[model samples]
Target: MTPPTLMSMMIAGGLIGLGLALLVIWFTPAQPDLNDAVKRLSNTSPHRPDAEASTVNGKERLGIWAMRTLPVGLWAKTPTRELALLRIPLARFYGDKLTYAALGFVIPIGLATFLSLLGLGLPFAMPVIACIALAVVMFFLPNYNAIDDAKKARIEFNRALGAYIDLVALERTNGSGVRQAMETAAGIGDSWVFNRLAEELNRSRWSGLPPWDALHALATELGLPDLDDFADIMRLSGEEGTATYATLRARSAAMRTAMLNDELTEANAIGERMSIPGSLLGVIFMAILLTPSLLRMIPG
Candidate 1:
């Protein structure tokens, strides 16, 4: 075939492929009903239980569609434990992964087309390889992001719990019983972590379960070990009628110390990372300074 005919055919093929992609996207199936999943997980709709639910937007909706339509389950296992810790739904997590993976797959196609139009043709296999590699990275990007978010959340929860412990100790010193102290302390803070604790305490009260038991269950579900320890202390106080004020005060102090230690450790690690680029810059400067001297010493 003549070059003109071949180029025209390629352009036509590209346009047709683009049109088919757009058509598929436009006809993508609606997201499956997540009500049952929500109810089973939290006994509440996605919106009512937390503030995070209120922030759902278009991208999340797209993710929901992807999650429903794509067979992601065959290869990618849902990070259920991490998602629970982050207070993210499994559906949302899967949806996010799908959205990112779709972007990964689409971006290379657009790039290749742009390059080809600019007279910079890549090998036939290059775009295919790039798409697969990018898609895999993007697919797991959400999981890494979720892990980091969960870590920060756990840190915030521990900080808040430390304050909560002190508040509980103060309430105990004011002559409240264990349950009363926990509920009162939880009620005193307006933070979301406090809100969660208060909700669990209220649930326990309504269900006639011990406050500590509720806390233990919440801790287990959310993977908060410090909260579990706090629950253990409360359990001891309730079961043995032991003097808990001193113990709570001690635990609160220990938690504050531990939190401080964690902050220092993280800060030091960050500083170490920041120094690396500066060190590299210094080495590069030294190399530049020495290059002329070394060249002069070399024989012509």
Candidate 2:
């Protein structure tokens, strides 16, 4: 057999194997064990829907399979934390990464194969290298997106939290207890962040835990150190019999100022970035305008 024929057969076999694997995965029922079902039922939070768990599609199933089969312990841990902060489930996060990586691998290889079939005569190693490089990059793309999303979510949550602190302080000034003030403030807002607070507070009420404890637990789970600090302040008010109204108000004000400073810093950075493109355009324009004059002076 010719070298080209052997290579073609091998590629064909690989494609067939991949297709069969996908088909098998698609047709297979993912039976939830008793433990998984119980865990799913018990883990429902008011702020996030249970429907997210039920909405897994075939591609996601494939990704889940990949995640289960691969020994990606170190790689999965960091992204899992980031995804949790973004309120994305671990299964879905893994699925997204796997899907991106698959696309990255398939696209370059397919393109190279098409070019080869069209007689482009490219070297074999180039496509293999490109496929690996693209796959690695695409695999990490979801992690980057999750990090950016988590950062934005934290910023928004902090802003809402500041407002919540102010509300709680106002309620406290009106003679409400710490818990009552937190519940009242949380109930006043329709935002997701506020809803999350209300959910945690309600859970604390149900579980016989203190509101501060619930907030601390949530902060720990979501990697929000600011929430932990707020929890500490509440703890101090409850345990030390301190007047917390002024403290809450001051904290709210400080948070707002910090947020404003961050916004201004980001705005200035964006303005600086905008100047770079403007400068590049100016240079390009100058070059275009000068090119003809320079050519004229070339003594042609």
| Cα lDDT for residue 17, candidate 1 | 89
75-176 in candidate 2: lDDT tens per residue?
554555466566676666777787788788778768866876887745667767888899899988888999899888999999999999889889878999
Instruction: Measure candidate 1: CA RMSD.
Output: 3.9
Top candidate, metric lDDT: 2
lDDT at 260 for candidate 1? 88
CA-lDDT, candidates in order? 0.78, 0.78
**lDDT assessment of candidate 2:** 0.78
Best by TM-score: 2
Specify the poorest-scoring 10-residue window by lDDT in model 2.
41-50
How many clashes in candidate 1? 0
Name the regions of candidate 2 deviating beyond 4 angstroms: 1-4, 31-50, 74-77, 281-300
Worst 10-residue lDDT window for candidate 1 reads 40-49
For model 1, the stretches where C-alpha displacement exceeds 4 angstroms are 1-48, 51-75
Pairs of residues clashing in candidate 1? none
Model 1's TM-score against the true structure: 0.81
